[model samples]
Target chain A: MKGFKYLRNVTTLKMDSGKCINCSKCIEVCPHHVFALNGDKVTIINLDSCMECGACAKNCPAAALHVDSGVGCAAGLITEWLRDHRLLAKVECC
Target chain B: MPRISADLTFADRLGSWRVRWGIGRMNYIVPPGLYAVGRPNSDSPVLVTANYKKSYDSVRSVLAERDCWILVLETYGINVWCAAGKGTFGTEELIRRIGASELTKVVSHRQLVLPVLGAAGVAAHKVKKETGFNIRYAAIRAKDIPQYLDSGMRTAPAMREITFTTWERVVLIPMEFVEALKPTAIAAALLFFITAMLQDRNAGFLAVCGYVGAVAAGAAGTPLLLPWLPGRSFAFKGVLTGSIWSIIFYMLAGGSGWSRFMALAAFMILPAVSAFYALNFTGCTPFTSRSGVKKEMKVALPAMACALLAGIAIAITGMAI
Candidate 1:
């Protein structure tokens, strides 16, 4: 996660300090280390580093983190689109 | 409880190799329950992992001679990280597994050691609240599990960091290659026959081989040289890789005999082919995000389609000439 940088400004990661319980769950769960404790609440220190894995949001107790998390997989997207169009009979994804 | 050895048998190695190439990958599972690694007693540390045989095997192999209680959860054969992302390895399941396995009876301590990647699904606080078990998000890799346990269950910074080294990339290549092989063969056979019937058999054979090389460029080359490849977008990197392959193919198969149209077609078709496969690799990567891949596909997909179409159109023209 240190050197592998992806496209910039694409991730939908947002943090609400007002809603944050200062639980540090975001810091703990984030593999990319995107969140950091600023005083009490966590801040998105490296927004560009976010993979939007949603680990932080999923683990957050106070509902303070937000990100559109899903598999960043082209095959998964194609499968979903096919299913939406009813072209695929069964949906399989990772 | 099944007392499983920490050491893997020759059969385990063979199974691992088979799965790496996408054989029996879906059903590669161990039973979802409790197992003892190295004869773990009740007081030994409890480590949780998905029931995916690969995941289970990784943990056990790393443990070697170490004593630990392995709680294999039913993730339907998915590895820890992906299963965690899908919520199959979520807090609910962990709590359920603990209760059902009568884990407290098996382990005197209430501590559950989980792979750091599993943090995506399991909430430490929720598990503690429900099951009264303290969840320690341990090492991301099984290799680091021993050190983590040795360090009194505290995760070191290195243990938490995610790295996509060349070896890591190498191990993932087999499945991706195999996934593309069948479809590619079918498409290539059709194209090869058509081209042979239409113009020259030599051209057909060369073109099919070149196309397969392009696929290899995307699926195998891009990932192996990923860190050094140009562009952050995988599709772009793949195009570059394909371009390299196209050059190599052209030089090897004697491009002197090729018409200008054929030469042009190689660049266009090969790069486009590579770009599509490279784009598909987003799912296999450690750092790529859902949004980033979506954005990349939005821009790259149309371009690849156009390049492929144009290349085919001109190839037909070149062949007719």
Candidate 2:
């Protein structure tokens, strides 16, 4: 945990202000404080800090938020890639 | 007791099959679309989830006595977090499942509660646009569901927290050990054989011991002693522990007169091996972030490589002398 920094730029989380009803649901739900409210509008202050957990998008009533979230583990990714490439069977452990 | 017995028997069969064929099947199929539980009424709360059997079972088993309607989306046997990351657990799937199951007719209410972790994949707005159903993200774990339902569907402070207690950490060890066994055994055996050829045949015992110690220090010690360890970095903690073990082994094995080079080699190699494996343990921890892990790897990996190279050089020089 100390040496490795999380790979954060891969997220697809986006906030559309037009769809945002200014609901603070995203703010309350985020474990990483990825969003903050600015005068009835939600903004992504720390996109890189996001683990892509999708808490905000799930709770957003206005449907203004979107993100690409998933397990970021190397083992999980390798297995997924292998399965996708048909190099390995659909197995839980790699 | 009877249910527990049945569950145990089923788990045994699954485990044996998994071991024999090397095909992990613990998380298999789950029926997609909305399912009623315990004769739920139209007004029952709709809980949405991925079609991963483990996730489905965890939710259903927890809510056994309660009446509810489960809306399971097609996640292709992936868990919520992974499915969300891959977009299999996203807005399109939710909308498609809703239409396919005619969920609107099953439930009188328009609100659907989903796992908080599923938010990454699902676009709440898209689901609403397609099905007119509002999404409510629940607490992190399914165990808090009964309380959430009782408390007007509001997540309490306790419910929101994710804990990695000792028991939880311990449970993770088995899977870690299982995953590591193949590589660890192969490496240990190769080292054992090589050591036997280079030195006394009994040297294989030392080699196996060293390899096993490195694995245990990295995989088991780091997680169990996570909070107590001196460093914030897992690799550092592992290296530190490994260094201590190497010193203890050196003292016990009476390797003092062997050479200064071998002493240095032992110190370098053991810790580097431990560090690499410990860094890999980040994937298993809960509090680790993607950015945090990447940063650790950048610094730790180079140090590990350097140490390993230095160790190899020292060992070769000692052997030649």
Candidate 3:
């Protein structure tokens, strides 16, 4: 994390602190340590560290977190686009 | 229950090496089912993992001198993290696997220890509700498994954090190298003949080597020097490496002999190639997010395409004269 940092202000991750049940479920699931408990609610500690893998959002019982999760590979995105456009005969992520 | 050997055999080692270089990589999978690693009783720990041989191998090899039940989930040969993201390693699969394997009968405890990376696909509460198995995310990497088990299954902070060390980057280089091999070869072949006909044999060979170097810089160099490389965007990092490659190429190829326009062409085209390779590496890295990569591609891809086309157009126009 010290060396590997991706584009800042690009992640779609959003946190609704008011809706947080203080379960700390997001904190436990987030691999990037993107969330922290500020008082009785969950807060985004480091938004840049959020890879938007969607573990927190999926695991959150209160539905307080949101992020459009998907594979973040250029090649994978291109393949997705091609598949959407019907350009590729077979769409493969790898 | 099938008993698995924690110690890897020569064939297993060879298979791993082959897959690391992208040989039979897609099909490199173990059968999806429950297996006993070491003599295990009902009270032994149950660790869940993907059916990908690499994932399975990493987990088991670290578990030597320990007794456990490994519950292998079918992930179509993809690694746990990737499979989880794609939903092949999701709740449905986990629940189904548990039922199919008769997990309840085999193990007295209703706990399933899973790798933390696989958390993306699995919902812990849901799994617990559906199958009555308490999901325990033990560690991010297999190397940390021993510590987790020995220390009363406690997940230390370091066990959860992902580290992309130099050796980790080095190992991934081969796959990137192999992935870029075909395209690089074709482009180099075409560049060699075109440059030879347009400029001279000497310049053609130099151009080909330069192009190859750009690919290496993007695929290998950028990753190795990732932290040291400037810029957050993978494309930007690649461009820096490619620019360096271009400069080094000019010096090595004797820029004095090549025409000024041809030199310009190499500078434009080679770096773009490097950027492309570097951009492709987002798939290999752990920290890169889908949203961030999408934003980067919107700008980087068009710029690279334009650079490539302009460099080719300039070379042709200059060569005609």
TM-score of 3: 0.97
Clashing pairs in 1: none
Per-residue CA lDDT of model 2 for B63-181, tens digit only, reads 76678888888987777766776788888888888888888887899999987777766767677777899888787788888888999999776555556677767766766677789
Cα lDDT of model 3 by residue, B1-321, tens digit = 689889989999999999999999999999999999988999999999999999999999998888999999999999999998998888899999999999999989899998888988998889999999988888899999999999998989888888899999899999998888898899989989988987789778887888899999999999999999978999999999999999988887787677777788889999999999999998888899998899999999999999999999888887887
lDDT of 2 by residue, A1-94 (tens): 2222334464567889888887787876675566777776778887765665666776677778776544545456556667989999866742
> Which ranking of candidates, highest DockQ first?
3, 1, 2
Ranked by lDDT, top first: 3, 1, 2
Q: Report the lDDT of model 3 for residue A25.
A: 74
Question: Which ranges of candidate 1 are over 4 A from the true structure?
Answer: none
Residue range with the least summed lDDT across 10 consecutive positions in model 3 chain B:
B252-261
Q: Write candidate 1's Cα lDDT for B1-321 as tens digits.
A: 898998889999999999998899999999999998877787899999999999999999988878888999999999999998899988999999999999978888889988889988888889999989988888789999988888888888788888998898899999998889888999899989988998879868987999899999999999999989968999999999999999899899998778999899898999999999999998998899998998998899999999999999999898777
For each prediction in turn, the share of the native Cα contacts (below 8 Å between chains A and B) that it retains comes to 0.79, 0.27, 0.74
Q: After superposing the true interface residues, what Cα RMSD does each candidate give? A: 1.2, 5.2, 1.0
Worst 10 residues of 1 chain B by lDDT: B34-43
Error of 2 at A53 (Å): 3.3
What RMSD value applies to candidate 2?
5.3
RMSD after Cα superposition, model 1? 1.4
DockQ of 3: 0.80
Per-model DockQ against the true two-chain complex: 0.78, 0.26, 0.80
**Backbone clashes, candidate 2:** 26
Point to the candidate with the largest DockQ: 3
